[model samples]
Target: MSEQEMFLLPPERPTISHLRMFLSDLAMQYHSLATAALNGDYHTSHTPFFTANGNIVGSTRLRALIHKFNTEFSDYMRGKGEKLKLVHSRFADPLIRSPESIFSLKKKKKASQAKHAGWNGYAIP
Candidate 1:
């Protein structure tokens, strides 16, 4: 097998949680390296990957990749939050349960009773 194929192949499929954890670890390392560079603490031997001023060579591509990841991840999280809010709203009781006027008193009473009759007002049935 080719070197790329060998690297790509794994004995088992990794779980989503594991992949997220791995990415989180990588983000932490990246943050640490960036902070060290900003604080002038980063020191390295002469390498093609870095310049004399401790800046990464070809950093534009890296910045683009980081920006893309941030945008995608933020969008994903926002979508997830919206979905969760939708689901919660589907089963949630109204905050204004009390009757505003005498005309709505009976309806409000019925709704309150029905809410309490279910499992914490969130039962599907």
Candidate 2:
């Protein structure tokens, strides 16, 4: 079956332990993806969250998760005086700019200058 269909398929009767395990795995995956996005690993044309055509992948699952969390999880947490907020939105760019390319460019320029400077083991004095 296609990946989309797989995602859409509801899980069979799951025990509490199975549900907990599934949620834990899902949380970890979300954390990893969020971290990558924050570190500028994803670009506009390429992101696991969106298809090449700009449609959100597994959107139904995403919506259901968000709805359940907002309603059930948030309420449960709030009773304990804990605050949890989940914002659903799309970002046009990464959270931070990647500096590795800039650093590499500067290194290359310095190396080029050094190669062209001075004489063999001596300065032009």
Candidate 3:
């Protein structure tokens, strides 16, 4: 091997635990923003939410994780290195079908199926 090759060190190792922690933080931040949006407090586009080093802190693990996730997900979606792309829809029909609709259907089914608390209430068996 050439001296340049020998001098080049491998990148630091990151494991599934790191990814999981990153995912957990991302989920928390997303949930926060979603709650805010649901409350009619969605941040405006002119606001700093879409910009780098905006109102949010920088140089943090969560930011790095988000950046990494965006890059990887974009690449994955575009089939950058891989030969395939995920066929899942990012957005679903809001009026005709939604997560709430699924939950409503489930509740209706449960109501029709059972009279006891196990099937009618929050408790699941």
Candidate 4:
């Protein structure tokens, strides 16, 4: 009935059911991504959500989703304030670090070492 619909071959036409299914799948994938990211499993959680129908989703849409979710997470963390510490600080964390601490690379003496140094204090010349 619409101009776009009229231009399509009958077999090529996408039905409402097809769009609904695609959105449903997207919602499920987004939910999975959110939950896994919250659980700190970001590396593994993102792989399946980044693809659909055996193909990677377009970069523009993927970037929007990543940005949107990251912003939401940042906001939530800001709102929660110290509440997140109750969940995460229970165990000693490898990220517990400070300048002058061995695990802390904040003082980049090693990076500044002539063995690895280059232009403008960056590795790149």
Best by TM-score: 2
Candidate 1's residue-wise lDDT over 1-125, tens digit each?
89999899754537988878878977987776666544544343213333534465444234545677999999998877553222235565565343344338668888978877856646665
Model 1 segments beyond 4 Å from truth? 1-4, 8-13, 44-125
True-structure RMSD for candidate 3: 18.4
Worst-scoring 10-residue span by lDDT in model 1: 41-50
Give the TM-score comparing model 3 with the true structure, all chains together: 0.26
**Candidate 1 at 56: error in angstroms?**
12
Count the clashes in each prediction.
0, 0, 0, 0
Off by over 4 Å in 2: 1-7, 43-46, 50-125
Candidate 4, residue 53: the lDDT equals 41
Q: Assess candidate 2 and give its lDDT.
A: 0.62
Q: Can you list the residue pairs that collide in candidate 4?
A: none
Cα lDDT computed for each candidate against the true fold = 0.59, 0.62, 0.60, 0.60
Winner by lDDT: 2
Please provide, for model 2 over 34-109, each residue's C-alpha lDDT reduced to its tens digit, 9 standing for 90 to 100: 6655555554433646343455544423444567678987788668653433334476234323456556778999
Q: Please report, as a residue range, the 10-residue window in candidate 2 with the lowest summed lDDT.
A: 92-101
Each prediction's RMSD over C-alphas, in Å, is 14.6, 22.0, 18.4, 17.7
State the weakest 10-residue window (summed lDDT) of model 3: 42-51
